[model samples]
Target: MLNRTAKFLTICLLAQPLPPAALTVTAAASENAALRDISKIQVDERRLTEAVASRTLTWLTGSPANNDYISVGRLANFFGFVGLRVTSGHSLKRSEVARETLSVLTEQQRTQMVSLVHAQKDTLNRAHEARQEMNRALEGLLAFEHVTREQFIELGRDYGAREAELGRLLAQTFGDIAQTLSTDQQRALTDIRTTHLSGERRQGNGGGDPKLRQSKADKKELVNLTARFLSWTTGSQEFNDFEVVGKPSQHFGFVALRIGSNHGVKRGLVAKEVLEILTPSQIDRLREAALQNAREFPMFLEVRAQLMRVLETSLSGGVIDPAHTAHLGAEIGEIEASMTWSQAAAMLDVRDGLSEAQSADLLAMRAKYTAETDSSDLDDPIERGRQLFAQCAFCHNSDSRQPIGPPLDDIVGKPIASDPAFKRYSPALVRYARAQSMWTEAQLDAFLKSPKALVPGTFMSFDGYEETDDRSALIAYLKTRK
Candidate 1:
């Protein structure tokens, strides 16, 4: 046990963040160096390199939602916003001065817009659920050795229909919002859209500057290494889940950590608990689990990469055909799911194995970490909400520049599923909305307590704020969105 501990320490020491080197066609020099070091122990340098490259390519071409080889998400990226800049900042922030200058929605206009959005909620929800179900079904078909072309075409047709419905809903909402806008407001939005488009064009001119891409790639590699280290140590699904370790994403590693529970505070705290509080027996078990994960990691990567290649080649004709390729995609999805499940299982095992004293010690460490990280002003719930909302910014848009989830501005007392700019409320949320006339404070509180519990099929990825104070503060902050 002592030798294993020493060996693990040495490996971690060697894995310490190193200075990034220049990029190469195949892989960044720094990445190769890091992988080479790991290869000496468990990973296969070449196979891992190929996998990483495929993963990176998959990210480059995929949507922000999912990194599937071929799915509605990828299709959305391809057919939805092929070369658009799609502004990253909030739409409300367009004006440096008074907020109303850019977004001139009166209470009446807001109400009308909200009503229009609400009307489409059922259709949008149904379409979204259909797409989701189709994706899942398609994912299941991957284990099969063969799939007919007709199968891919049929799935493609369904995916296309669902995607088209979503697009129509978006367009309809935008049209309704535009009708509500006066001439000046329309001009303001047009100007913002034009500026964003120009910026996108410039970015695409030389692939947004090779230097920028290279720098980003280098940093991403290091970030990936750190996340991988975190997973190997803690086995927390937050750092090692399906989206983070199981699949490739442009927004993997640190970026993905933003939406995790407790805003991922547990990630930093878990290592301390494992190192200082865990028993010798527990550590030995964790070490063995880590070793087992390390051994399996390379094979999963290799198979996933290979599957991605097969899917890409089979479906490269600018058509959404899933057939045999869907099988491969499904297999990839399964591998990703397995990766997540295995780590989560290991984490649960360790958790179940913990002594009450050890668990108490870990909880104490967690409380300490949470307190240390709590920089919000206790006296001001709104202020605290503003600080805490960082966890939410990733999914919810503060402004109206195409939200991943929904716009939160003036959400309190507003009709549920009534964001003019967002039309993709899940069926569960829509059902919950039908029972409630508006987003009452109590409803928000209960929903925030556990979103899935309140609205089971809602696609809001947040696990909900557990602390009552935190939830209150966030609701307070949200009340000020108007």
Candidate 2:
């Protein structure tokens, strides 16, 4: 009779009705409270753990992983669960079992769960902020000799104890809510917690306590300097240039000084520094505008200054002198003249005053620069060609994997048809690949000299190289692969 009664009770438990609406509302409220408490606990515990871990690892092993990766709140939550499991003696293999036990909620109940989860996440974010504040305080305290390791550890221990108590209370509250819920409601709550809460916990692990990287005064000064430099460089109203033929005549001397002062440019390094600082976007825009207008546009002084600084920092020697600056300005003018209108428009994303042909030219230029090449001989030109190749290098380099033309890395050995990553190949070139076996050095040399004639439908717009010596030198240089 007792066995039958036990069996009846089990059936009744399984057949229990869906929870009352009130129960779900209460559970959601309780879950939110629990999560908030858990967040605080986790954050506090994380701080303690990080301090201990950093000290132990540094002392014993002479190295430690970056403490910046640690999140006290997350660690607290994980350990809190471990503590709960320990106390309850629940030997569930996975949190999924708990979810399944709570899975019978309605759509409304699920939404409530989501709302609760969001609330929990917000609390965790606040907790993170608090942790950061504490860390900053601790960092400041470290400057003093009176605050010893023992004191730090003691403080951490206190934080940990408080966290553990919070966790215990949350677990107790959750258990109480679970008891009141119907079997279905319990399952829904479990599912929500497992999916939503679990994700929050995982994300909480890496957001380290914020450190005070700079003083307010320093930050303010930096901001001011940046604004001034940007205004001068970007052609903002502050350093307005005098207009010549509806275009601004750049203040070259002022630009040079700005570059020198900001970047510390000397003689030999000035030209190179200036070139390096000009972004592909800036150059392309300038070049296109020059081509379209058939005139030189003054460079923004602010832009020049920024470029100079970048150059000075990147190179060994200081900034450029007057003569070199003039030379650089001339070179820039020549390059700008060679730019097609289309290229300029593309850079600025401006359609004003640009012809279709100019737009087409810009697109073509961009395509040429972005396109991949299989020619191994492209980089190595003969000794005489080396000087000439410098012109080409203005738009190309190994560092950026982008030049005004395709990257020449591993071009020599690469099969013509195999590399799909090279998107710049003309349709004619693609067809040629199908017809030919591979691109050899000799074949590349011939093609470079007369691209359109070699591959009639090829999109290469450059006039073929007229000098055989130039072609041969270019080929020879290309042979010496890096």
Candidate 3:
């Protein structure tokens, strides 16, 4: 039924393709159909994945201006009033208000908030998965040369089902949180909500510009502070770890937010501690790394802005060449990779000279927020692999084009470096592939254990999964793709 409807709509669209006015009408009709379908469909709980859940909650609770179009400032305010602080002012530095909110909470209150968030994690993930399913349907529609109104409607219907399910879960979670809040907490939250809704723009120092008061020294200090905070959060100096094909810092940022919004509390303390132990030469190396990051970080943001423009154009129904999007994605990926790599290398160079006690202090600080995976709940290898694959999403699109690396579709048993579409495989990998032929489960396991070990100088920059179970789970998950 969908295929026939799509075919008919496509024919109708193509019939009057010459007129701009006709095209606009057809687009509007399609959009209406999609919206109508969205209202009618129901969500399938079984198909929801963790990635979808994480994204859904993040989007639902993020800032409207920065996170994504679906982000609602009101939702962010609500979450911020609680323990989570996913959204903040437009700055790389951590939000002072968010930190203060969490700090003011009693231990019991913080624990309650954490438990509530964790309890709702599964439901949020399912909703997120539903949205992802809708997006996949949309992608399928977009693949057609002339997408039809009926196709849009059909896609909408599928999405509508998911949305309905999502709405139910979200409402329940919200009510649960609201009912759990103490009277005092509720009152404070109400005040915070009013402040957000007021939309007051007071001129603190003539026209409300805060940066005008900053001295050159203050600005330099901020840059160094940001660089150090990022480094501490990541806790890695491996260049390979940072050179992946997406915004690497975002993962760190999100981790900090989800854990406890602890960045604000720990960043300054860690910076001071590290400085106390650093030798003059180590200090110089660290400073150089901070300066490099301070430089590249802006360029990374600018490239990201460019990518956003391309996406906006496409979303606006403008005819976009896929190659253009791919080019920009690649460009932004490289800039982010370079920035992270420099920051990591600098941290490594400085940390190399740290005494045992100094090393322990850094480790102790890191352990405060670093969460270990709870294997009890996620005992399924495929499920665990799916969760672990979030990091890999930065470089590889499983169901779509291999934007950075070869697509993983039917990767199991495939010959290495043989995806004709992925032309940028390192020569070393190709030679190894020719020698070894097919990527057997054993070969894949070995490769995942250490990419460089299997094929020296391989293009894959992953540091490898050290845990046997992790490697096995990832491999098992990869096999299920087909």
Which residue runs of candidate 2 sit more than 4 Å off their true CA positions? 1-381, 391-405
Candidate 2 lDDT tens digits, 1-482: 00111111110011111213211113442354233321122112222222222121111111011111231223223112322222122232233322232234334433333333333444344434433332322322221113343443333333333333332332232323333445544334344333333333322312232232445643332222222211111111111211112111111121222232442323224323322334455434444443433321222222222223222221222332334333333332232222212221232232222333433444343232211211222343454344334323322332223323354545565566455554566678788878775768777777878988889987555545666766777566556544
- The collision pairs in model 1 are 142-327, 152-322, 152-323
Question: What's the count of clashing pairs in each model shown?
Answer: 3, 36, 8
TM-score of 1: 0.31
State the lDDT of candidate 1 residue by residue for 70-150, as single tens digits: 221222121112111111221212221112221344556444434534454565455455444433332222211134434
- Return whichever of 1 and 2 wins on lDDT: 1
Q: RMSD, each candidate, Å?
A: 21.6, 31.5, 22.1
Error of 2 at 443 (Å): 0.8
Ranking by lDDT: 3, 1, 2
lDDT of each: 0.39, 0.33, 0.39
* Model 3 misplaced stretches (Cα beyond 4 Å): 1-261, 264-376, 398-402
> What's the distance in Å from true for residue 433, model 3?
2.1
On residues 131-153, what C-alpha lDDT tens digit does candidate 3 reach at each position?
Answer: 34333332222221234434443
